[model samples]
Target: MANETKKSQKILIVGGGTAGWMAANLFAVHWPDMEICLLESSDIGIIGVGEGSTPHLKFFFDEVGIEESEWMPRCNATYKNGISFVDWSAIPGFNHYFHPFPAQTDDIFTVPAFFSSINARMQGHNANAHPDHYFLETYITAKHCGPIPTENFPFGVAYGYHFDSGLLGQYLAEKAISRGVKRVIGTVTEVILNPRGELASVRLDDDSFLAADFFVDCSGFKSLLLQGALKTRYTSFKENLFNNAAVVMPTPMYGIIPPETKSTALSHGWAWKIPLTTRYGNGYVYSADYITPEQAEMELRQHLGLLESDVTARHLQMKVGRVEKHWEKNCVAVGLAQGFIEPLEATALALSFNTLSAFIKCYEKGGYSNQFEDAFNNEINARFDGVRDYIVCHYKVNQRRDTPYWKDNAANTHVSETLAQIIHFWHRGGDFAKNLYMNNLVGSYQPKSWACLLAGYGVFPPLRSDEHNAPAPSLPDMVQLGDFIRRCGLNFSAHNQLLDHIHRRPA
Candidate 1:
């Protein structure tokens, strides 16, 4: 028996969309001396609708040395505070609710205070006031202010960006190539497996065979290498998440680009409106079981005030599931190649980044051990399942009964035991902060995020008779909070002004 270790030096990445380019760039950045080759075909177009992202994207930019000034204007990027969900609840005339970036303020305890105040008011102890009144972060969003960073409050503003995915891929490709990554423009005609059943090489359409010690499947939903070569099984989430198709189109911008992504609940599923510098990225995510793509498009056109013939919409089929194993036999899946949930909370980019980050960490510590693989698969699976549940929470908590879709989601939607347990504990007023800390179910949405969705939809547990409801914050305190928000808003510029500033600034 040979007692030797094989280190991965030559790496081949299949497909070159955002995920492919991102993997190439990050791997090159970390392992500059390693030979990294990305194979992509120009004929195949990318499903580039994943524009919105979470704050974790900032880490990727910083690590790769891509500054905001450089990528922002080029990608038509605009700052994103968080998501604003409209008409999700059954309550008539309830306009909207915000899931703002975690409140950034000196008063870290203010969230608990705000929660108490909102609960007290909702219990009829004080005059009704919107929940945003107590939290400065949500209040800033309500004021339509960009979450710009200030000297004293460096981390006070939490934000991400909405950019053109195609442009982003181009930007990253340039960066990756500059960092010594080889770019090969060719289609992967076949994946060749070694006698040991591991990915040995890939055959390009040009009749060339490229071999590498490791391979990354960024081939999007095709899963060419991981599933196609390794025969990895997939676990579907169709029962829990009903959205399997999306109708996407671009509409001309009417006014100022808001900093928040607007997700409006429709009769079938939901519609997303993401503002870019030049246009609004619009899409309707719905279940095929409930409505056909043609019907979905009609509903989307009606929502956007467009005639059926006015817009030429693109239809996307989404596989609402993840591969049984992300890291299988020297090949790992990233982006849509691994799994995809609907873009309810803008998690696509974050998931890609996290998966790659985890793989890098595993690779660094003696690559390819059973122990490492087990831990990696466990964490990745948990993250995916957690995200699935979070998205499911949105549909389950909706109070709407107007349509069969809403009624079916509220009554018969599949609920995971993990999510059900979390909800149970939350309803019992169990230590939310503690559960959020300990569980750490998903990377993107935390307890505060869950609180926003749960409370926004008017989903609450019955109050125990012995529960002592604390009085709402005093008038003076409320006034003080309002003043604080106003001062913070002064520091942060308007959303459009920030975009203009970024565009005008010298790269």
Candidate 2:
């Protein structure tokens, strides 16, 4: 086979939402000579109402040569510095914190100081370890400013976006089509598989067959080709993650718009408030086993002060987990078809890009053979598990005791051995970061992320007698750090002004 002549690859993508278009665009950008045709079903609609992303999204747009001005205005997009978590911790002065994305200047000095303070607090020393003041993005978000630095600022900051998921799909669809990617709209009624259990072609409702050298299943959760055709086993993370449903509604947008997503703790689960230029998207993610859908919607309505209003809410069910193998045979699954881990971290798009990137590299490395298939699956599944551990940590370390859901989450012993190891070493306050890295325990997240999520929730032990009155030298200099952050914040523009600037620009 190594001596065989190389031929161009033909890829058929079955789905049209953000995930599908994303796959189409990435394929076109990566392999210009490949025949990429995205087959979409008009009957299926977009899943998520509003969406946010990790820093990886910015990299994706840059790679595709789509400027912020090109897509943001059309999609009602807004800059997202990071997620601001409120009421996740009941401890006073610790009830709210902003988890900033990685910035250029963070590692210079703040991260080391931040980690030092966390270790100090865990060691019975009176130290301020709250995450709100440690990172520059916190101050930028606190002041309702955009993430883009001004001309005078020498450092850079990583940021994502909040956009209307449906509009974004259309935007990306047009972009993909303009880039030589073909679009075929038809509902898939049947998936034809070869005797080898590999995807051969798909039968549409019109009884027409479409075949390709390779297939990508982006048909949402039904997994038309990968799981439905290949019978790939699905793994459920229900053991540690309990929220199965989400109710979404939109609230009126007014006043200053912060360049960040707001996640507030709720009784059954957490509520997300995402700001878009047109309106604010709000949703409550809760467990159906604990609360009914109607009850959840009512709670969300009340939370948004819309109990008396006639705003309708859309209820969505989440199938949380991944498949046994992302790339089983000749077909690979992306987006909802691949698997899900909830949107706690807004990682769907990022994860999708990462999968395609990894698959392309691995597949090309093996000359489109299945040589690296197992390696790709192992890497992607571990990535999913890593993110799950981080999200599960949020619930496990939560200070809430009002609901049985929270109680059960904290008491549940279903966590992986890797997570338990990190937690066990966290409280002891030794070289935990070194231990995590040395032991290969740090999967997708860095030590700073682990520290941020845990320390943001005030996970330190109680203050001892002498520690309560511990000397000031051991504590972080909040006064000086505060001055540094606020001063640096002077460079960024207001969140509203930045969006308006983009909106005013000619698309």
User: Every model's Cα RMSD, please?
Assistant: 3.0, 1.7
lDDT of 2 by residue, 1-507 (tens): 222112567889999878889889988888888888999887877686538889888888998889999899999999999998998888778899888898887887688779778777887777888887799998888889999888889999999999999899999999999999999888999888878777889998889999987899998988888889899999999988999999999999999987999999999999999999989999999999999999999889989999999988999999998998999888889988998887888988888888988988987888877788999999999988898888888988888888898899889888888888888878778667887888889887888888888888888888768854765445557788778778888999999999899988997
Q: TM-scores of the models, in the given order?
A: 0.92, 0.97
State how far residue 386 of model 1 sits from its true place (Å).
1.2
What is the total number of backbone clashes in candidate 2?
0
Worst ten-residue run, lDDT, model 1?
1-10
User: Which TM-score value belongs to model 1?
Assistant: 0.92
lDDT of 1 by residue, 1-507 (tens): 112243436889999999999999899888877789999988887888898988878878987888898999899999888888999986643457888776557245456655655455444444323444555556666766788856666447668899998999999999899899999998888889889889899888889999988899999999999989899999999899888999999999857788889999998999999998888999999999989999999999999988646678999999989998999878989999999988999887888999999988876664444347767888898888888889998888788999898888888638988788667656665456566577754354666777777767766533345434653344336666677767766677677777888988888
Clashing pairs in 2: none
